[model samples]
Target: MDQTQSSSKALTLARHVLRVEADAVAALADRLDGAFDEAVALILARRGRVIVSGIGKSGHIGRKIASTLASTGTPAYFVHPAEAIHGDLGMIQRDDALIALSNSGESAELLTIVPIIKRQGAKLIAMTGNAASSLAREADVHLDAGVTQEACPLNLAPTASTTAALALGDALAVALLDARGFSANDFARSHPGGTLGRRLLTHVRDVMRSGDDVPSVTPEASVAEAILEISRGGIGMTVVVSAERRVVGVFTDGDLRRAFAQDIDLRRARLADVMTPRPRTLAPDRLAVEAVEMMEHFKINQLPVVDDAGTLVGALNMHDLFQAKVI
Candidate 1:
């Protein structure tokens, strides 16, 4: 074929493959039945961890499922079937539950250790295309992961079948996660380096400037005094306060520019006259991400942190959220 024709054919084939794989994954939802429920129940009842095993492409999918299960409060690990035959079968315990994946339900490597797992009193859940296959028949629960066709043009590579298996694995993990009442905080604990961790685990108090670090000026002070405080605090804003240290208003660099443009004398202007009254604020215990959202919404760079009675306790700026990775 010519170069243009070859590229065109390849593009068409790629689209066709994606369509076939997508259909395979979609069909899994309709195939759900009593077996899926049984599998979930068995796993939930187990006091020990889940042992996932498979061979070849199924092994790759099994590893992902095990990882997902571990992260979502299910405590699972993948064991290569080939390795299990060599010596890794020692990892399986009597109280553990086993999930074995094989499209044909007849992989020799998996069969080698299945009997030992059963002999040890571990429950076996089989994910396979053939319900009548030996592994499915022997399993305590059989989850149907069948697909009608492969995405490969030759219909020989494991494409649609693997996709269906992977989707079913995700469904199982999510079902278990819901059953266990796993919260966002629990999920964040498993992914402390991720953005969700920063959002859920970081509070405003952890990042906000406290004590004398917060810029402040009395309402009776001059606008020039507030400007000096804002500069000294380096957060581009200063809180105007009452005698009892309750926040009355806030004066930012932006407010200074506007005041100057209006021809107001900074030296003579009182902070009360130049500051924004009752500016947007947040509680110290609130999430840093909430501060980010409020700042973005109100177009403010800094916010005074307050107590339940609206007493000024701290101060935070956009840089604080960014430094905490909440941005």
Candidate 2:
């Protein structure tokens, strides 16, 4: 074929492959029935972790499925069928559940180990294209991950079938997540290094500038003193406090600008004269993400951290949240 024709055909083939896979996943949604519910219940009823096993492309999809389940609250791990027939079979316990992935449902390696897993009293949940295959018939719960055809032009590669199986696995995870009352905090606990974990688990105290690092000045201090404190703290603001260290107000760069706009003498103007009294504040126990929301909602960058008695404890700004990866 000519260069232009070849390029056009490649683009057309790519689009067609995407459509086929999308349709395969869409079909899985329609095919859902009591079997899907049975699969979820089977997994939920188990007291031990889930063991996922497959071969080839199914193995790749199985690993991802295991990861999704693990991160979403279900304890799961992937084991290769070949490895299972070796010494890895010891990993399967009576209390555990096995999720076996096989497009044809007749994978010799999987079939060989299915009876052994069953004999040991572990429940089998089979994900396969053939509902009546040996693996499905032997399973305690069968999940039909069938697709009409492969996305490959030759209809020989495992494209659409893998997509359908992955989507079904996601569906199972989400259903189990809801059934087990899995909350965002629970998910965050399992994924402490991710952004959602940082947002949920990180508190104001964790990111706020505490003790001497927090800039502050008494209400009696001049605007220039507050300005110097603001610059020194690098947070664009300084807290105005009483003799007891109780927060009374906050003087920010915006406050300084307003003072300049009003032609107030910075060298002589007291902080109390230009500071915002009872400014928006947050307790040190609140989430850092909440601080981001408060700052966005109030159109302010800096916040004074306070205690129950409104004592000035710390301070933080948008930069702090960003640094903590909580924004």
TM-score of 2: 0.97
Steric clashes per prediction: 0, 0
TM-scores, all candidates, are: 0.94, 0.97
Q: Judge candidate 1 at residue 91 and give its lDDT.
A: 93
Model 1 vs. true fold: TM: 0.94
Candidate 2: 10-residue stretch with minimal lDDT: 264-273
Cα deviation of 122, candidate 2, in Å: 0.6
Worst 10-residue lDDT window, candidate 1: 265-274
Which residue pairs in model 2 clash with each other?
none
lDDT tens readout by residue for model 2, 1-327: 799999999999999999999999988899999988888888888999999999999999999999999988899999999999899999999999999999999999999999999998999999999998999999998999999999999999999999999999899999989998999999999989998999999999999999999999999998778878988999999999999999999999888888889998778778889999999999999999999999999999999999999998999999999999887
Predict model 1's lDDT versus the native: 0.94
Model 2 clash tally, residue pairs: 0
Instruction: Please give the RMSD of candidate 1 to the true structure.
Output: 1.7
